[model samples]
Target: MTTKMREEIDEIPAAAARLLDTQTDLIRDCANALKKADPKTVVTIARGSSDHAAYFLKYAVELQLGLPVASLGPSLASIYEAPLKLGHAAAFAVSQSGASPDIVAMARGARAGGATTISLVNTIASPLAETADFAVDIMAGPEIAVAATKSFVNSIVAGLAIIAAWSEDKALVQAVDALPEHLQSALALDWSALLEPLREAESLYMLGRGPALAIAAEAALKCKETCELHAEAYSSAEVLHGPVSIVGRDFPVVAFAARDRAEASVAQTISKLAAGNAACFITSDKATGGEKLPFIATGHPITDALALIVPYYGFIESLSRARGFNPDKPVALKKVTETQ
Candidate 1:
């Protein structure tokens, strides 16, 4: 029997296509609202896999819109009962279920604080969606896996669509238009290159820079959830600052390098880690010592990073089975975390 995680992973490409095709009206409406607001800063609210999606958008917004994006802690509203002055900002809250209390709380707080808030959620009827000024149903369908696969991809894709529309950037719009085909191609990639080193390993490090850092973080979380391995994600620069000391012959590092401005620097860092005899592999051809993993170039920086995760999802799901665990039902984890 195929695991739910594997089935969901395989559905990722179709899930992305569904969002792009069916959610166009919602995407355009939200984008038009953002364009009208013309906010100076963008704030994001999310947790876990959703938070990682926010991180990916942070870089894209900064790079494309020339505006900074910050991730606001949900505790300010949910736990501390504090408020923010977001009159001149925009807030994007991403959630698969859209039912988390803290996510809904922060989103409501952002709206009350005067931010033009929007939600990219799988569940359109959920609380987070109701609280936002505009809600985009990401159209990932019902994901049965405890570990998020399709929803994560759709969240990022939905955000990218909004960004393209808001900025009116022809290049980005083209990139967004081309993602379904690129994502389909990404599904076939075999990242089994990570298997031998990661199979028996108890711990690992995932490295990336810029938007790819978000992919690295998501990959690290998936490793922990599915394979029960301890994994840490760090920027290419930050790891050398201290984390590199802990890396030895037994350590496995997977560097995620996209076809973006930061690719060479990330590849360079991977090469340095490999020189220390760490079992290092990278997703770029620029790295010298590290083994190169295959990556699909989506002809855009942001999509290049996002596309790397599909093969990774497949790899981790298979790794879970190999290690005698069910990826669909990772121990002690629920599909929706209703944190307050």
Candidate 2:
């Protein structure tokens, strides 16, 4: 019985606190750099769950600062993506460890093109941070288990700081800043309602669109690593594209409804699924003006966005115990996945 093998959940709350505590300066500097940045557009380079964070950041940065945001997928970052045209804009390569050579190269390319490159990572001195004009450390610390328990939550926190820094919005910062405390409270909520279906199910799909899709994708990734469950994530539209075919009564689609224009479309999809008798668990804030889906409410939009990730810590961790799998030590998965 290894200590690393058993103590993932117990360590997360403390690790998250450390990540937040150490990030004050990083947040301030990233915010300061973004303050005077007359950026034309924004681009993010990331992979796996980090890719989804880029999607969420794109929406938040665009909504708060009104800048166009795009994802430079790992595949495209090295080869396919064209020369980014935003000469004076901002580009961020978000990685948990700042590994991912391709994103490093992409950030370097953006720097070569005279764009301001920023790296967001958990480690202070990672390769991804080496080339950026600025770097925001997530400070989730050590993350001894490979599935990225605390780093994911902290990266979202760091992203919120970037949002506050760029928009100079104190109200939003306070809301997000207060979340670690609220998250401790959120942890006390009876999560059985959320975890039961997953415990019994052979398969589950966590779905969301627009900004919240990234949260769902990350939730799915966590479920896979911790519980060894067959879980996946896709855009609400992308799910409707093909995943709808496999949808009968047993398959559940956990959908996220955001406050933006994408909300209407996502709500409509949930309605269609309900009409067909598919199991749908929907979570959102009041910003949706009350969708017809069975609701799990959250706080304000930005806080709500951050809170969407709160439920799964217990959900997967509990499920791992029920199924006798060690959620912390996922087979063959390492903390830093290195590749060219």
lDDT winner: 1
lDDT tens per residue, model 1, 49-102: 999999999998999999989999998999998989999999999999999999
Report the lDDT tens digits of candidate 2 across residue range 299-325: 456556556565556556677767777
Model 1: how far residue 37 lies from native, Å:
0.8
lDDT at 168 for candidate 2?
80
| Span of ten consecutive residues with least summed lDDT in model 2 | 286-295
lDDT of each: 0.93, 0.70
For model 1, the superposed segments whose C-alpha errors exceed 4 Å read none
How many pairs of residues collide in model 1?
A: 0
- Per-candidate TM-scores read 0.99, 0.84
Q: For candidate 1, give the lDDT of residue 235.
A: 98
Candidate 2's TM-score reads: 0.84
